[model samples]
Target: MHNPALDFAVNKENKTITIKREFAAERPLVWDAYTKSELLDQWWAPKPWKARTKSMDFREGGRWLYAMVGPAGEEHWAVADYQTIVKHQQFIGVDAFTDADGNINSAMPRSTWDVAFVDKGPQTLVECLISYDDLAQLETIIQMGFREGITMAMEGLDELLVSIKK
Candidate 1:
């Protein structure tokens, strides 16, 4: 239940995980959910886990804070700061865990999450790139439940993409 097989590529320096799915919908619709807070709250985390955002300023120099509720009734707080935002194209941000008050927790390793949207004919390509400094950080992430969590989270995203009720 803890470790799962994640579709990814591991280089000598870092691990790169990728998921490419065609959304029956168009690019704009898929892009909006990633940028907008209301849509993101619908299916950001994996199922069986729930989250609520405290703040979401989706712009350069902006920040978003959220709390994830675990299956065992535990809560983990995470915060992300937007560094660069290119409309309808890309979102580059630094992610970290923090307290409910949104204080930065240094214990959690910080990394940049790069999300890009590319038009695939009439469909959309939602590419998520996560980068770390070196191999050790990559291992740390894997040991910290990264593979299982990302797989579950991406599956949730895949469901949202194929759903017509969005």
Candidate 2:
């Protein structure tokens, strides 16, 4: 088995972050892991933090509302509004921190995410581009440990793929 590396880059001038990760699974399975709420809840959050979806509608113009629950039982909610979707290939969405009622938190940073899945023989490569409105918003997320959190979450996904492959 090949060990895939995660490529994460921050482009300050563009106010965006790009992440590329290769998974040992095929494109269809990987796409399901990302698009299905049940599958995502299994590996979306870092350890000691659990993801719980309150509601989800995985169509264009629909939204997913979920919370990342801490070990202490605290919850941080967020919503991802899907703008576009192309089965097994790509999807675009706007993500924002939100209240439990699904109201966006204006003070928090919001971003537009473009995620693509590509077939690479036995593996699937996921490319993600996240754009913020400005550099300040990008900086805020970075300072809040976005890099570390996402890296951990991806590692969780790696474990998930391996277990589900059998």
Candidate 3:
């Protein structure tokens, strides 16, 4: 697989995690990979952890429910509640840990995500801004290895895009 062009930063002042990445695919293709469940399943999680969507509706007020199954067969459920969608351009949503039955887990940190897909001729640049409720919550996730996990997941996305391009 080709190396991923990705940048991950945590802003202390804004209390947010921002990830910037460039993919060889066009904006529409990148957008589809994000909004379409089947496409997301191919690259959403890190290796040895497959993503399975329980249900998805790609629109404002809609939700994408999924689970990340580990090599040991452990499943971690999560849900993304969409707040705004701008077709192949951008989308904003709130993500939270949840149960298989779609019940939120209050003990987990929740994050608001703003994802933008910028057209760059034959390539697309994806910027993701993730905000936590507070510094404590932010620290919690960072300590949990969020950065490494997301970096690995984005590399998976890079691989998926390369396969599609071929």
Candidate 4:
């Protein structure tokens, strides 16, 4: 099992966002949570929201695309491209909002996200390091209700962790 840690913070200048979580599972299993759509579907969205993973090709040069719709039919799509993958140690990718055909929406800010799965005794430490282009871009996301959205996303991840423990 992994020992999951959970916390997220914006950089002092508000140009970056970092999320840390530990899971009481093995690195490989926890890694699958982020890389595989099957596992993601179980805990990808918080209550009142649902995730419909359009595609998840988690390999270098591959893309991960997903659509998360709220209860009221309001939907959002996101696309991430894998830049690096170091087995169970880490995964780095660029995330952005996109459309059905896997095209960058351009209307959204693009950010680099680095997720590390560190071995800690019998547990695993998962840290998500996200950096934006600038402070203004970060602010734009915040103004559009990012903090709560992110917090809720993390909570969805937590739900997944609990299910694995059972």
Candidate with top lDDT is 2
RMSD vs true structure, all candidates? 4.6, 0.9, 1.8, 2.5
Candidate number with the higher TM-score (2 or 3): 2
Q: Please give the clash total of every predicted structure, in order.
A: 0, 0, 0, 12
lDDT of 2 by residue, 1-166 (tens): 7667889999999999999999999999999999999988988998889899999999999999999999999999999999999999999999999999899999999999999999998899999999999999999999999988988888998899999985
Candidate 4 residue spans exceeding 4 A from truth: 1-5, 12-14
lDDT of each model, Cα atoms only?
0.74, 0.94, 0.91, 0.79
Candidate 2 lDDT score at position 1: 71
Give residue 18's error in model 4 in angstroms.
1.4
Model 4 per-residue lDDT tens digits across residues 1-166: 4433357688957589887777666677778887889988666776678888888888999988888788898888888899999988888999898887778877678899888888876567788888998887777877887777766776777678667763
TM-scores, all candidates, are 0.83, 0.98, 0.95, 0.87
lDDT of each residue in 90-122, candidate 1, tens digit only: 889988889999998876766778888888655
Strongest candidate by TM-score: 2
Off by over 4 Å in 2: none
Give the TM-score (vs. native) of candidate 2: 0.98
Error of 4 at 74 (Å): 2.3
